[model samples]
Target chain A: MTFSDIPKFKLKEYSKAPELSSKTIAHKPVIIVGSGPVGLAAALDLAQKGHEVTILTAFDFIALGSKAICFAKQSLDIFDRLGIGERIIEKGVIWNIGKLFWKDQTNPVFQFDMLPVTNQKNPGFVNIQQYYVEDYLVDALEDMDNVDIRWGHSISDIEVRNDGARLDVDTRDGSYQIDADYVLACDGFRSKIRDSMGLDFEGRIFEDNFLIADIKFKGKAAEQRPSERWFWFDPPFCPGGTALLHKQPDDVWRLDFQLGWDIDREAVLKPENVEPYVKGMLGDDIEFEREWYSVYTFQCRRMNRFVHGPVIFVGDSAHLVSPFGARGANGGLSDAENIAWKLDLVMRGIAPRSLIESYNDERIMGADENIRNSSRSTDFMSPKNEQSLAFRNAVLELSNDYSFARPFINSGRLSTPTPYHDSPLSTVDNDEWDGGPKPGFPCVDAPVNDNEDSNWLLEKLGNDFKLLQFGGKAPESDLDVINIPIDSLAAQRYDAHHGATYLIRPDQVVAARWKEAQADDINGAYQRAIGAA
Target chain B: MDKFNDTVNISGHDDIYQMIVDLHADGNEEKSQKINAKLIIAMINQIGSEQIVKEIIEMVRLNEEKYNPRSSTH
Candidate 1:
């Protein structure tokens, strides 16, 4: 299907925060600043956990432009937990194969399947425009009575109190003060909350610019092309640079061309200048209309610490990375999930405030992993020096004949769930295992049957701390227990042959696993997982 | 006839190459050369074999001689 017209979103006008009778300043349990995917996800998770959430955003409407187009499987699973996964998957173009071409070769020098371990409900990735995700999340949030999304609200100033933080918000209606028990700074790269608090990030700013040309082709050519990620390194069309092509829903395609640091941004962004490059890739005979054109430079940076007093930074407010790995949005969603569950426990007095410290430690580990991978990809794509360039060239040159060198030719390492190997929240393994998800790793999903209906194991796990017991009856405990037979795919994936039991955290991370469940050990590990030990 | 084991030895080869390339990001030839010398010594210690080190040095010298005869070290 060829869609020539760009999708238009309805922009909303600002509304005032409701006036309170007793308190002049409105007190909110949680005030999340920013209406992006991260903020929305956090608000949804928290609201579902039975907390009142007020999400404030500067923009009145869904974001324009097909930004952050690739949604990883981990992100899809999170969206499933949020109840919008089906809608996203329905609208998105599912792709598992990525073809990497070197130079003008018609055949790919290297190809990869994003999902090595299969039988999961979600694919390796879904190429959907970011606006659709935000719009759907906003729709879901509107249905919940506890989530109040305030449009056109921006924080002008913030005062950090020992108990919580007070925000001076500027809205279209007027200015007001909001005393929030917790403030989630999900604001983008230029976060007002982070800036107001006099906090900054420690990271590297890559020295290259990329021009994104989102276009829709006419005729049958657009439909004929496979919906797979196509990347070209030093192609004849854009010599000495990298080019990426991804297909989004409604026949909208994203074309990213890496322009070196020396080019004039103004001239390069011109339609006349960009048309030739588009024609070079999709032959001159193919007719296409420009939907969106943008020029962007990226950085890999994160705050020294994500947590500061009662105010916590999430999403781009906490960390930023080059867009190569699609880690920016995916990592932010992980941050949202991580803080949402922990913040819920702390708010309910089930766990101490110090439990939030683990969020900082674990997310920092995730951010560092993202930065390291993104930085390496950047260095591989845009070589800093002649020596580095030579190494890159050697890797590419040797990849044609030698299979060993192909792994080194990194166009971009696609996003994967970061396993918190050294997370303090995890209870280390007490028993030896051959192959299964270890503590501090996200749980693997497998097809399972509930009664006669088919479902996923993660779906059954939901967003709670549950005891997954294989081939055993429900144990006597306050924690939720899910029992399954040992002869299932889930048991095989979890290596539950000898009746293994796992303690799954609220965020679906395996906190601890045992060869056999013991009451004393389960209690100890559960306490440790919740930061109560 | 002689058989050769043409297997890739380095695990995470790209990262090792990146680390080496990053060391030269400043474009300081002398500093990189000295650092590389130190790295080689440290790696030789890790290898912990006199005969293997000698054989590698000879192979490198031969390759260097074949590539750039005028700049050869011996």
Candidate 2:
């Protein structure tokens, strides 16, 4: 796309911290590279734990148009403790429904409403622009006395040895060397930290490029729906065409369209043609004020190892997904929350450094799941060849008629978090108790939680290591767990499919699933996850 | 939600995937006109070129009535 002809639009800017009070730099333990979601979340989590934390960002925090929106329930919960979720929720849109369009037909085919409610409070997700989430996190972190943010600074070089990590950081003004006891590489896909360490990023590069445009409605929207998400499948405006219509918290709409790999970038980006792309997707009758438009390639690459020595990668630095499943940022934030708590434990000497291993164990599974789901979604949207398209069409054709088969048709390949069935760090305890929600988690709104003030249960549980169990005495052990005692009636209804109690790590993946609670069970699971047992 | 397991089930597939990517400015003091232009172009280009021109036309043509098209887009 040509850089010129970029239209004027409202830019949500974040202010940078002018200076950090001088401190004994050598005493800091954790240093995070990249102020992206991953770095920010990790820093916030670490800083909150009373660890000496510092972050180096290449650009001014507010200047970067962080390409993310909305935190999944798992992420929102983390923000709650950081005291930022409230402001974010206020500024963002809460959308539980997504509508799709096929040839001459409008359908809300794949609604997340079908996904079991997230613990009777949060549904599957929430929608807010990434910038707002970052702004909130950065703003909150700014006030903290323990956290130091170095803006306009980049990691020029990294040295990993027995003595923690030595980093040569550069700024537009000058360069300096910073040392830390541990490093969290929250940098993005093109992570300098990951690269300097000589790690391999393995995955398929999606040959397609995706374009995103944020616009404002000029009039009544032709298909104004509360779903918060809309996709188009069949002809008229954009058939087999991929576009995302999302509502921002500020009443602005975010439109994402895949412009194909072969389009002439310069011509398509011209002021004249840019409007047509908008007109075509929204309909001839609708008009929009362009806010911002940019193009990106669809890459599904992830680093082979998320953790390297004292330096661990979080967020996009660990994995990069085509934004299809809305997994990239949310997934990254989840990484932060997961590692944050664990690292806090390890640093405070409550848990061993091996606890950091679970960070990889959990997020890689998350990465794999998000990648597969996103890849599936992106594949459906772009459909590599004619055969895939035909298969998709057949699914769509049978979608309306075949109630059982509709998901394959209506869901334009969306990515969701994945569960780990085999984890070396997590145990699979086989005790015989009535089943309920397994630990690694997709929160369900059981009928029992209705009417009660269940919002707190949903908000805080998964943000940390949550231990959920059905009736009977809570598993007595040393694991840091919040007991989610459930009644048998609700357990039976959900348990016909539910297994035993689950041990969920900070990232909200089942660290262990048990049928019944065995003696010393909680400690066993904890020992297995963090080398305590 | 399409049940992949007991809890987390991601629904809807046959349609085009629509993932919304947000662009934010944290809290900037300087009005970086160049930053805006660069970001606008970079973001579009970052996820650019899905080759959906024909598909977009078909969507408007077939679902013109069903989709509540934004007037400003047209």
TM-score each candidate: 0.87, 0.77
RMSD of each: 8.2, 15.1
Residue lDDT tens for model 2, A1-533? 11133221223232333322234345358888886667887888777767778888776535323267656665666676677877877776776666666666665454554244444444456777666667777887878999888766777889987879988766555556777888988888888887787786788888776567777674457345464677767545554566677777655677777677777766765656767767876677776776666777868889888888898888888888877667888788778877888888788787788878877887898898888787787777677765566556655654555454455553444434455556666675565535444545544434444345543444545545666665454566654544444543445544623434567665555666666666577667766766565
Cα displacement (angstroms), candidate 2, residue A340, comes to 1.4
- Give model 1's TM-score versus the native structure: 0.87
Q: Best-fitting candidate, measured by lDDT?
A: 1
Clash totals for all candidate models: 0, 92
Worst 10 residues of 2 chain A by lDDT: A1-10
lDDT at residue A382 of model 1 (Cα atoms): 94
Error of 2 at A229 (Å): 1.4
